[model samples]
Target chain A: MTATLPGIADIHHAATRLSGLIVETPLIESQELNKRFGGRILFKPETLQRTGSFKFRGAYNKLSSLTEEERSRGVVAFSSGNHAQGVAASAAMFGVKAIIAMPADAPAMKIANVRKMGAEVVHFDRVREDRMTVVRPYVEQGMVLVPPYDDPSIIAGQGTIGLELVRQAKALGASLDAVVIPCGGGGLSSGISIAVKDASPGTAVWGVEPEHFDDTRRSLAKGARVTNEPGHQSICDALLVAEPGAITFEINRKNLSGVVAVSDQATRQAMRDAMANLKLVVEPGGSVALAALSSGEIELAGKCVAVVLSGGNVDFGTYAEIMAAA
Target chain B: MTATLPGIADIHHAATRLSGLIVETPLIESQELNKRFGGRILFKPETLQRTGSFKFRGAYNKLSSLTEEERSRGVVAFSSGNHAQGVAASAAMFGVKAIIAMPADAPAMKIANVRKMGAEVVHFDRVREDRMTVVRPYVEQGMVLVPPYDDPSIIAGQGTIGLELVRQAKALGASLDAVVIPCGGGGLSSGISIAVKDASPGTAVWGVEPEHFDDTRRSLAKGARVTNEPGHQSICDALLVAEPGAITFEINRKNLSGVVAVSDQATRQAMRDAMANLKLVVEPGGSVALAALSSGEIELAGKCVAVVLSGGNVDFGTYAEIMAAA
Candidate 1:
């Protein structure tokens, strides 16, 4: 069966659903940082989003699309990071019971945060089993599954950011030469590309990810989906997804100008600069596109660029260790 | 002399003049913090403003009001902090020469920042002479003096924040019980009170300052203008002004619902919380109102409050120490 992919109109519909429901994060810029890069770079910080990431946009939208009977049966998501919190919070808002499946190796704080939102946490063994195999049992038990990035509704939901970015950039009287977005499972980048490409066809949309977890970059280069090596290490925990979703990859391949990768060191530098210069706390995964922009992985001279700092759900100790290294 | 003060209409006019020039900063709120405080607390973080503070609003407005002759003669400001940067940035924008007078003991980096924007810096002996006496020579040299917080145009400019806040809060479907603002020389609080009280007359407007430098609070209590002890000290450096401005006091005295003070410790804690929860970097002076709100210094149960985190110009070293101590 062929499903029509989400488009700008769907994104507009998502914005209608999300109106006054999610925080309209601001587009911020720094004079010194912009001067250093020899360009004007506006940043959309979704760290201010409820649940500390842009994932909330998609999570709430997905839940909002569910039928009354589906909602009554409850919802479940399989993730250990911002998606878990987004789903948990959205479920609580809808007064639905939610079961969040996570790797047993996930941080205690993350699990606690999910539980704090009144969601049940089911632990999966990361060493032997993947989240899908573990979450299948719950899905079979009458609970509706909320896919992190693959669903059409989820893509449309995240695309609202792109709609907002285009409008905000225009309001600032800025002409966007390009837009850089962090790509984990490709939901955010792909959604944003669809919206931006429709609104400003001249603006190039680039997707950035960490070095070893550059599955999206490799996949785009090969014109096919490719998986990262199962055991690669990087500090950008949120972006360590194995491969791009089938639906998301299709959208990205069509709308995105290119996909790029930034080193862990550059990612940390971007995170540090966000704190010192931009006065924002960005998680490592959220800073990869910023890393690429600041490090000149992309040529930015005399350009007006927009970059997304996707989240801020980092632990203090990890953030301190990174900053202290500076 | 009986000069009329600026009212809400003046603020609306200023907002019109500043529509595209200034950043219409978003009103941010932390879900976790709101739940903990037992009320919704919206933060207008001017830390995201141009030159890293709300002072830029007033500085640019004051510069815009200057006659062409005044522009040709250049401008001078007697602030060692945010106001200096605001004036320097505004002057640079207008292609006008600017002189920033600071204490001899002011941070070298601050002096350098002003100069980097093509402004001249003059050092004054704080122990022997005040900034006014030291800047008189430059004023006599055909330079226009840009008052930090006392002028009617400056107050009207700062009042733009109040207008933005009222509109944003309404958009969020929130009815504010009171609005708490950081009081320095009373320019920000007094200006905000005029705009907010006009728009939401039933909503109380309270000014918060540092404990040792609580001249506004004391003056409100005495029903007359008063001064703080010159030798007292506090960590809220930006708010350490000894007394409210002559023009600012009259507006604050009549319009403010009340005035209060927060301790240095509470201020530091608020800074840390802003970083951890709101993902924002708030300076010592900027966090006073947040400090009061978070510390329960005011009756907050079941109330919807709006607080301003006025600025974010803290040295990372100082911020590190506070976060580490936590």
Candidate 2:
């Protein structure tokens, strides 16, 4: 399975192909964060993306493979959040219709944003039945099914950030000791680890997961896919996937240096730090890498480190609530 | 006066010298804004600056020019907002002690931010007495007075953004029809107007000011400085300067093509639009250019336009108030 996966070269090609569609968001040095963490920390702010999330990169890449004739039929994706906006926005860019299947309990802000992007929203009860079941009809109706993760195109697209990180570091003449990536279904981590290792072999790549929902960490330790139906609650809903993808697990197991888990308190504090210091509005899922740094889950004594902020799709009200909660 | 004044060439040299002290924020293309304005619009997001404002550039540039003997004696500035943070942060970088004189009525968030930057804060009763009266002694005692926008170094540093806009536009092989710049003390507008006109003579530079504080507009029309009382009401405190600086007014009047004024309503709406569409938290002063666009005060029919978002130093509690007002 590891041998079957595409490496850094494939990801680099995807990045070049998807150039103008995705923004090369600013990689900023955090002066406040450096002092707080006792070492230098650079942030790759994907919150400033076209759809306010790095999901746009993977979504755009997946849609670019479709022929004009196929695009006319449109695309369908099952996400109540960032991926929905990404798919809808990428489809809109292509002048194609997008249908989004969302949970009945999806945030109003998320639904409004998806509709604003010209996507037709179809609601389903995720607790009662599988959302994918509702998405099948759209696929059968000649619509392409855009998976949020667990797809090669998505993984390869995310790996592009890893290539960008290495290039950015070289451009700034900053040598990184580590690059911390947040792990959800592991598509981003798997892809980024491969590219980071390939581009800077001496730089270690660490995956950070919420302590409560540490599926990737467990999966890697067990050397197999593991499910977490055990009610371990995490505020980071975006990174609460039940298990790691089979393809992604194989890549992460071999490529990632290690996996680190941070407490929910650490995640919330990191979110506050990001807003106050970095002037970024990162969702809890996106701030997991920073959480790892703050909690000493990853040592940053004398080394420069870069953290990928996965997305900024948190609703403003949700952010207010999270800050209040913190 | 024009022959004696420094133009784009001198400003360009200053821009090159001050590059590392400032963040080269993105001049992003806004699809939503283009659809509304019937033309392309580039948003230069200076909200992502070191102190959440472009003032850092000017502050750092001024501090960098101090003699070794003077640097050890320290620096002082009279500001209750972004300028205080800028001076404090920049001086701290150079290991210089900074004493900031702030109004007692200044927002707690701003005061806290300045204090966190490791500067000594001195409270002044702006309601009872003049802040400049207190600043005079500090300057007399050999402490440098870093005027918010009335100094040469400050204007030269801000002109760098205009230089960046030209380079960024040329890189894309696109030419700007007009560049919209926000005016407070006219430092940003005056410097930018010279740079833009010199680099691309075809591009017209327009200055935007809040209607409530139209001293700059009045002064330009009267051919003399028009001083308003400190009570001129404006949500944009950063732009509530009593009058345009002498040097800034002379250059702006000679170089700027036009001046546009927008209401507080328009400014608030622009802030909402930035949050909702661009996922940015721009302060009131920062959103004035967008306000001018949305209010139809500045026409952009089929033209490529750029607007500088001067800063994003708004307090979180006040953000809700601004949105509610909108």
Best by DockQ: 1
Q: Give the per-residue lDDT of model 2 (tens digit) for B1-326.
A: 44545576767777777766677887776566677889988889888888888888778777876787888888999886788988998889989989999988776777888999999899988657688998888789998888888777778777888888999887766789999988999988887887888888879888889986878888889988898666557777678777888889888888877788888888888887777667677888889998888766566898899988888777666775664543
Worst 10 residues of 2 chain A by lDDT: A317-326
lDDT of each: 0.86, 0.82
Q: Model 2 TM-score?
A: 0.94
List the lowest-lDDT window of 10 residues for candidate 1 chain B. Answer: B104-113
| Top lDDT model | 1
In model 2, the Cα lDDT at residue A136 comes to 98
Off by over 4 Å in 2: A67-72, A230-233, A323-326, B1-4, B323-326
What's the true lDDT of residue B205 in model 2? 88
Tell me what TM-score chain A of model 1 achieves: 0.97
